[model samples]
Target: MAGSEGPLRLRDWLVAQIESGRYAGLSWEDADKTSFRVPWKHAAKLGYQAQQDAALFRAWAVYKGKHLEGTDKENPSVWKTRLRCALNKSADFCEVRERSQLDISNPYKVYRIISEGTQGPGTILPLEGQPGLVSKDEDKQSPSRLAQEGSLLPATLGPSPLADHGYQAPGPTHSWSSTLSEDFSNPDFWLHVRLFYGTALVHEATVRTAEGCCLSPRAIPANAAAEYLLGPQPRMARVHFPEPPPGAGALRHLLPHLERGVLLWVAPEGLFAKRRCRCRVYWRGPLAPHRARPNKLERERTCQLLDTRRFLAELCAHLRAGRPEPEYQIRLCFGEEYPGPPDQPEERLVMAYVEPIFARNLLLHSKRLGSETGP
Candidate 1:
């Protein structure tokens, strides 16, 4: 055992960093997903230090337990997912949830002390499912609240696309049922449109499958969020919703189904189905993605946000046989420094042109979405 000092070392480092205001300069990510990004400069220190105190990583996990010094019998709703926006090699990535901001009262200190060493990690139960959606506040909100506060869908259509919350088959005599498994091994994609009301993430849908945003996915590992953001998700899921009839089944109506953060399957057109998963971050009109890259010397530079306006425009013209509407390619960019994955550049991207059915289906519902509501 590394004694109490093993975990205490980490606690000390975090305490010192807090004292020196390391967290004061945090990097932003897709809506509602805030990581306590380890600065690139500090990567070396954490790396060498981690080897010294192997238990350090245990203290860095997303653990849930009662406060070490609280009188209440129930655990306070405190969460800590250790991650930071860091280079893959550093292994220093960590997440700081909107609500999990640490104060001195945090129980991590007590848990770390009792746990002993890396191998002897105590019972600080780690979070199992999607770490993105684990915030206490989000737990309280039902699907209805999310729609009213976050979605662009009409009030009537939302809350639940299925009227009964759990709907039966079309006929009175028939009932269709399928069990949903906790094992989300089935691959899919989520199409996310995060609207930032000024700096606050008003509407957040992380890619739970591919159509949502952060505070968003299970497919994405909590530690590798930066890499996922900077690159395209590799999967064979082809997402397509049924085209609705003329008026009622317009983009707005289908969105309740399309962008609901779940995957829809269709029979393949041929031997294979098209698999394209692109994640684009849109800022209000005339605005670009926030630039938050750090120098190589000062920070590890784990990811980058790059824009894809020029390419999408040319492609739009060639495909549609005419120039796209003025509001089509509003000022938007890929949230990371690079667009698409390595050896492939054109695939994972889109322009927010609201024609529906095509041109980034159901992406930007309305042109004025960019500046519809004032900051």
Candidate 2:
């Protein structure tokens, strides 16, 4: 009678009955019993309602599907087999069993449909004839479980405030360049970097060259540009490097023409080739003084290299201090400057940024080199 409205569908009426507290505290068995009492235009209408109720019950069972053990096992093995088969056939429409919150032993399984898409757990639905039906254990457990798991059960144990009207949870936040620049120190940003690069010594980094290429420690012909070969025996665009100025440090002396120079300790074989070697190079430099400050794109590239250096310097310091290395990836950027003609294209550099991959192997390699070299 409560759900009797003009042209209201049976499923909609059933949802309304539960929401209006007309059938509160009624188990599936009891709700089915009450549905029989609804007066209809004809017996066929009554039969149709029954059919709808049966279909709804089946859907509920499938959505809440989980393996039952002990006293909660309600169906025979054969019935469960048939149910599993039916659920498998309708997998896309039904909730995945692994993802469902319905515990096999939960007494509140009958109320799951009523609470579907509700607000956070611990919502109390007062049953019509049962005042103390909300169990004390459930009252304490729900909030604790929600806190521990960081998720809410859609519908279970009570009425959902979310289900009463059109309500939606806030969408997940997406990371963009601005967001990354603002919070480069956030663990999530580093996690994303690690995920993108996988577990390798070489990582993808910002390049100043028109043609992007990865840099590795290796010899280059004097006439050729220093860009690392993407593959064996094929020459690529050369990176520019002018002479370094006098009074520069020993590392800077290696490349006299570059500005804002820094030394990068590279494996003897470079960041590529698997063979063992020990070497260092003056790999990165800042923009020239006469040049304007880098635009947004260049700033991002510089920030990436700086962040990588910070991480690696920390790691190296930790290793030198004889402290246990923290479980994290170490990243680095290698750069080579290319001098351009004044009237033609401006000078640019190639920066090869590497992600933390095969980290333990690198650590072991470093240790072995240190031991052999007595450092």
Model number with the top TM-score: 1
In order of appearance, the predictions have TM-scores of 0.24, 0.16
Query: How much is the lDDT of residue 261 in candidate 2?
Result: 25
Q: At residue 180, what lDDT does model 2 achieve? A: 18
Q: What C-alpha lDDT, on a 0 to 100 scale, does residue 71 get in candidate 1?
A: 45
In the order shown, the candidates' Cα RMSDs to the true structure are 19.7, 28.0
Model 2 CA deviation exceeding 4 Å by range: 1-245, 255-353, 356-375
Query: lDDT of each model, Cα atoms only?
Result: 0.25, 0.26
Tens digits of per-residue lDDT for model 2, 166-279: 111122223311111222221111111211111221222222111112223333563322211212112122223323335535435333322222222111111111101122
Residue-level error in angstroms, candidate 2, position 163:
32
lDDT (tens digit, per residue) of candidate 1 on 182-236 = 2332122222233222222223221223212222222445455343432222221
